[model samples]
Target chain A: MRSVSQKATPDASRRSETARRAILTAALDLVGRVGYAKLTIEGIATAAGVGKQTIYRWWPSKGSILFDAFLSLTTDQQDGALPDTGDLAADLKLVLRATVDELQDPGFDLPMRALHTEIVHDPVLAADYATRLDEPMRELKRDRLRAAQRAGQMSEDVDLDVAVDLLFGPILNRWVQRTGPLTHEYVDLVVDTALRGLKP
Target chain B: MRSVSQKATPDASRRSETARRAILTAALDLVGRVGYAKLTIEGIATAAGVGKQTIYRWWPSKGSILFDAFLSLTTDQQDGALPDTGDLAADLKLVLRATVDELQDPGFDLPMRALHTEIVHDPVLAADYATRLDEPMRELKRDRLRAAQRAGQMSEDVDLDVAVDLLFGPILNRWVQRTGPLTHEYVDLVVDTALRGLKP
Candidate 1:
């Protein structure tokens, strides 16, 4: 029950952040090497050289620990913003190209994939991941497309929800299913096809 | 080395088929329960009520067993197919509506999700899965769209790949990510949006 007010005592605050970071790093490392099921709080604590209570005080479960770890790894654990450089197509292309880069990074593959697999199997983890990770990305994508629409780039009647999916879904399908090589060319293909209406 | 000879009796052929079905079923049940990593050849043997020698004499690894299981599951799995009753939008709607039904079916979810997530991390498994499952579904969708294209119902310039993704991507995005409710209404939204192409 010790909230931020109690933690704001400088000594507590400093120790908490340090332990939190250590715990996250350990969790990420463990999942990367051994996968999600094997990565436990005790294992993470031993690997992090922190007490198990330290991790439990912050996170309730191993899945929770992983949720934080993925968040921090992706964007410093904040509600990260997507790029908004003013051109709808350019901005979309840029964001997707960066996403392709992230997916391709060797350091990210294992743990991210582990998290993905876990989400598929465990409903609790899937719900938590969706609420915390997936929805934000979706909203971010939607907001960007809405911005484009307001700027007169997209059609007024464009279904924002499906449009967001059209932009990002193929990339996701590729990543989750490993259906194809996720090259820059592939990302461009998605962006181009999504935009300009994919019709003659 | 055990290629069936013309002189070989029907009994041997029936036995081989029976073994094949047992291995496939065992793989599905085991992978569904324990996961891909822990699913060993010995484990499959025990689960299938066969000897380890019987398994090794046939398939090579757990991956191949699961691969065969998934193939059979997909082929006999369910009836979520694109309807070709001649109306493109209606056909698409019917197909997607069935997919929504499948995603909602508790029996269909866990195993399919299990295999999907497992393959995300396993390259060999992923490649085999893509070949067996993802590729075929994609091609089916593409062929449907192509037929629509020829019938003057769809845009010829629309990349069938992109169009298919647009058609099914949101539904899948919801299913895989668990972002939102995947209802008949949601399917209708995507079907309408994708067909319209957002051009004023």
Candidate 2:
């Protein structure tokens, strides 16, 4: 069993990439319009103008496809890479403000919410999402906090794991609950408050 | 158009209260068994040994009934009131630990997740849940923060609303995302870290 990368020629690889992008776009659009409960693999295949077998060849299930689609949508953005401005407060504020913008964007909001709702309802999906998406994003934030600690901006004793949660959790809570507007001011406050605690 | 309170004699009021508790119990049980998407008022009424109109008389919709059922499940516990031990750190740690316990309880977990899923998918329900449940919970935490500020344990300049989010948001995020264990040590770290930021 040869790997796809090993077996494919350059032209074949390019075409597969195009097909992948189209499939993801269709999946996101359908999930946004019909929601997670209503979305189906056949619907995504029809929307993408791909055969059902093509989707199955690439993805094991609709959930995995939707998860990959979410990752694709987010990867082009900051995708959890924090700015290393050497000013901890300024860097956090910049990253979090961008997050507020992403959370509020109409294109990202509904599909993301649909995915989150499915995760909440299904334990297997929830664990898979945690491993595939949540953990990677958290590790990126943790790396930044570790850098701050090395710079002597943050205390050496501050737990990077807990600190990452402190930094991103409020922003996520607001997004999930839709408790209030996800504004720049709100992110600024979250950064300021959490950083003050982490500062040496 | 008489209110239930106005129409009820003492015996009738006691019987009505019993019926109300039964309905809520049935709603929670059914939601836990079949999930929110499959749960219905008719199923709950049958399970609770009441007529369908009995449920309709009290709740405007299944979502409203589920919301109330969640409130009933939680109200007997902390109910958002932080322990005012006068030591801000101790008070916060105690409150958050209780929250971790609540989040992990199998009895409360599935039904609460179901209600949360509904809120995520429906804008009107999301607003109602925020106003009726999330806001009140935040306010209770805010009031505790205010008291800490007046006592000089926390800075007067700390934005109470933002502070409240910073305090509770990490725990809620963990609960929603299932990112990691909601351990006592985790809550202790969260309380200590956020309090460090808030301290004058």
Candidate 3:
């Protein structure tokens, strides 16, 4: 989608882009410091050195701003594919281990966890989250699994949705619920254990 | 733990128990009606026909009240064991399907989801959640899996924790994220796939 500023003068468009970036950056920084419950639009505006009206014109609420801020970071970091080294287990472990590291990073963890907390309570935000972030990422996972199925590394009869959930669900559940430690060894075991059933 | 009321007269103890029940009931009812965000001590007191001091004397916060209320409901419903029909897959499917239904039930859903939303943000509450609710439930699940191991229905080498997560995680992830329909069929497939593996 083209920006509304596309029809505006070059100088005006550049300024708009600058303000947008600043607001997103400020939202992430402030959320990390103050926590999501205490984060306010006035605080973000003051931190960003922009008018509160500027933020209001673009995003309706702090939740929306945080969504965009976290989404921007994710989009910047991802190259749009789960790594595929032709070994399905190795590829999954590689990606999931990276995820563990990212979630552990203080900079990323607070904002992402904040976004998840918001997603749990708000249905509209959850829909936006599913459409924009989750589905695309899930598709990338499915692509890798599809490749594995074709390579005869996985059963062709396996349902990709269920398989995808099986592959990623334990790690995700732990993160969301804080049920267990997120670790490289944990991801490796999760991958190995999922690929090989409990049945003897 | 014995109630403090155990030291009091039987009439006084009975009165205290009645008030305690009222507060828990009111907490769940109010949360379901107005949501956790808007639930307040004043509101709960009015609904329960008790003074605000009554609620304060017992539970320190709304979160605690909701926790007790939810815990009571769960304990009453559970029989202290996952069914051991001596069929691992069928037993797991039976319990998980019941879980799926409980999550879908209107009376149970709102307060439970409210507790989860709080747990996501509050480390203290998360700890309480893990110790008081999750660990005991997980022990029951592990017991069933251990029975499976002994029966030769499962591999003895499998990590019980990881095995437990594998069987329950997909359904839980789906429910928490609203990522898919929570159907008995979905739970059945998750059990089968996790037990059978994707390896052909």
The alpha-carbon lDDT assigned to residue B100 of candidate 3 equals 89
Q: What would the per-residue lDDT of candidate 1 be over residues B7-52, giving only the tens digit for each residue?
A: 5767878888888788788777777677666778888888788888
2 or 3, greater by DockQ: 2
Isolated chain A TM-score, each model: 0.88, 0.92, 0.82
Candidate 2: lDDT of A53?
95
Badly placed stretches (over 4 Å) of model 2 are: A1-8, B1-8
**Mind listing the fnat for each candidate?**
0.62, 0.83, 0.54
Off by over 4 Å in 3: A1-19, A33-45, A50-64, A197-200, B1-17, B34-45, B51-63, B198-200
User: Can you write out model 2's per-residue Cα lDDT over A1-200, one digit (the tens) per residue?
Assistant: 47776777787888899999999999988998998889999999999999999999999999999989888877878754778989888888888887778777777888889888887778888899999988877788888888998999999999888888888898898889889888888888888888899999
Quick one: ranking by lDDT, best first? 2, 3, 1
Clashing pairs in 2: none
Name the 10 consecutive residues with the lowest summed lDDT in model 2 chain B. B1-10
- lDDT by residue (B65-148, candidate 2, tens digit) is 888887787676865577798999988888888888988887788888987788777888889889878887778888898999
The 10-residue segment with the lowest total lDDT in model 3 chain A: A1-10
Q: Single out the weakest 10-residue window by summed lDDT for candidate 3 chain B.
A: B1-10
Which structure is stronger by lDDT: 1 or 2? 2
